[model samples]
Target: MTLSENGDLWCDIRTLHPAGNHPALFLDRDGTLIELVDYLSDPAAVVLIGSVLEDIWQANKDGHAVVIVTNQSGIGRGYYRWADFHAVQARLYDLLAAEDLVIDATYACPHPPPDAGGPAHSLYRKPAPGMLTRAADDLNLDLSRSRILGDSVSDLAAGKAAGLPVGILVSDGYGARDAEAARVLADDGFEVIRR
Candidate 1:
C-alpha cells in the first residue's frame, strides 16, 4: 500500500487475501514492530525486531490478517516527508518479503496534534478508532475477534475504541517506561507481554 500524492491511502485491494472474516493483528510501526528511532525516515535505519516478525508470521499462519496501522506524526510535524516514509516502508516490505511474510495492509495517519497545527485531536491518530475501523471496513475483518499489539497505552486505547477483543503491549521500547500505566489497561483486559 502507498500513500497517494494527495495523502490518501492507496492499498492494492487485490493483494488482500482475508480468510473469511478473520481477525486482524493491528500493529504499530516504531517501538512495536521495529526499533524505536525518533521520526525515522531513512531506509537504512530500518530494523525489524525478530520477535515481532515471528509473531506476525505465526498470526498469518493461524489465519489472521496482519495489518500495520501506524501514527506518522513526523510528516505533519515537518520532520520528514511522505516520500521518506514510503522509502522506509519499501525497505520494510522488501525485508518481510525475503522472509516469505506479507502484511495484509498498512495504514498511516500523518496528522499531528492540534498544538502543532495538525487536525485537532484527529480520529486517525492513536486513542481513536478511525484507522482500525477503516481497515476493518476495507478488509471485512471481524473486530470482535481481532487484536492489537503495540508498545504504548494509546495503541491499546485505539484498539479498545475500535471494539477489538484484545490489546497487547509488548515490553520493549516505550513499554518499560509505561509499565505502571499499562497495569490500568491490564485491569481493563489488555495484555502486557514482557520481553
Candidate 2:
C-alpha cells in the first residue's frame, strides 16, 4: 500500500476485502509491534517481535483488515527526517512480507507539538481521532466495530475518541498494572495482553 499526499493509503481493496464487510484492526507501532527506541532512523533498528505476523494473520483470517496507526512526533520534533522514517517503514514492510502478513495500510502523524497548537494538538496523532477518521474514510471502516491494539494510554484515548469498541493494550512489563485496571474501568471491553 502507498500513502498518498492527501494522507490516504492506496491498496488492492479486493485483496484486502472481498466481501467488503470485514472489521478493521488498528495497530500502534513502536512499543506494540516492536521494541520502542529513541527514534529509529536506521533500518537495522527494526525488530520483529513475538509472533507478530502470526497474530495479525489470525486476525486477518478471522475477517479483519489490519492497519497501522502511528505517531511519529520525531519527524515534527526535528529528531528524524520523513525520508528516513519512510525508509524504516519500507524495511519493516519488506520484513513482514517475508512472514506472509502484509499490512493493508499505515497512517502516521508527522506533525509536532508546535504544529498541533493547543489541546486539540495533532489531528493525526494518537490521543486524537484524526488518523482514525482518515482510516475510516479511506477504508470505509466501521469505527464501532473496529479494534485498536496499542501499548499506551494515548493510544487507548485515540481509540476511545474514534469510537472503537475494544482497546487491547500490550504490556511491556513496566508499570502497567494501574494502566490496565484503568483501561478496564474506562472501557469494560478493553483487553490487556501480558508478555
Candidate 3:
C-alpha cells in the first residue's frame, strides 16, 4: 500500500497495467469485501467473503477501477489507532494479492457522528459523496458509469450522492439484518443481491 502525496492510501495498480478513465467499482470495506467484525483492529482477523474476490477480479478484468471507501468510526471512537487500521489494510492487501486481485485505491473517514463527540459528521463518511468524489478526481474515474457495492444503505446512499448510476447491496454482513431496508432501496433503483 502506498500513501500518495495527496494523502490517499492506494495500491497504484496502474503500474502493473494501464487503464484510463474507466468506470469504477466503489466498495465498502468491512462487511462488503470482508466479514464484518465490530471495531476490527487485528490484522489476523481479516477474512474475505467468498464472492468478493471473484467479483473484484471480474471487475478488474473488465477494466474497472476498484476503490475502497470505508467509514472507520472506530478510530474516532478511540477503539483503534491509525496504525492498527494500516496493519489491517496491509494484511488485506497481502491476502488480495495472493488471489491476484488488486484494488486501485482506498479512502477512509475516521470521523464520528455528532452524537459520538469526535467531530461533526464528515462529508467523507458514507451517506456523503466526499470520498467518492476525491477518488474519482484522483483516479480519473467516470462517475456516471460507475457502480458502488456494499452491505449497507450508507454505501448505496454515498454512490447515489456521488451521481453514480448503480448501487448493489450484497446480503451479507450488516445487510442480513437489513433485508427490508434493502428492499426499500431496491424500490428506489438500487440492486439488492442475496448472497
Question: In terms of lDDT, which candidate is strongest?
Answer: 1
What digit string (tens of lDDT, one per residue) describes model 1 on residues 1-195? Answer: 556465634343324663578788999889988899999999999898887888788887987888888888898889999788889988988888889888888888887767777777586788788889888888889988888888988888888888886788887769888767756766445454445
Q: Report how far off residue 53 is in candidate 2 (Å).
A: 3.1
- Tens-place lDDT digits, model 3, residues 90-147: 8998999999998878888776766887556466777788889988887788998999
How good is model 2 by TM-score? 0.81
Query: Worst 10-residue stretch by lDDT in candidate 2?
Result: 7-16
What do the candidate models score in CA lDDT, each in turn?
0.80, 0.70, 0.79
What pairs collide in candidate 1?
none
Q: List clashing residue pairs in candidate 3.
A: none
Output the number of the TM-score-best candidate.
1
List candidate 3 segments past 4 Å from native.
1-20, 186-195
Better of 2 and 3 by TM-score: 3
Model 2, 110: alpha-carbon shift in Å?
1.4
Q: Point out where model 1 deviates above 4 Å.
A: 2-14, 187-195
lDDT by residue (tens digit), candidate 2, 97-177: 788776777887765555454224457766787888777777778887888777777777788888787777777422274
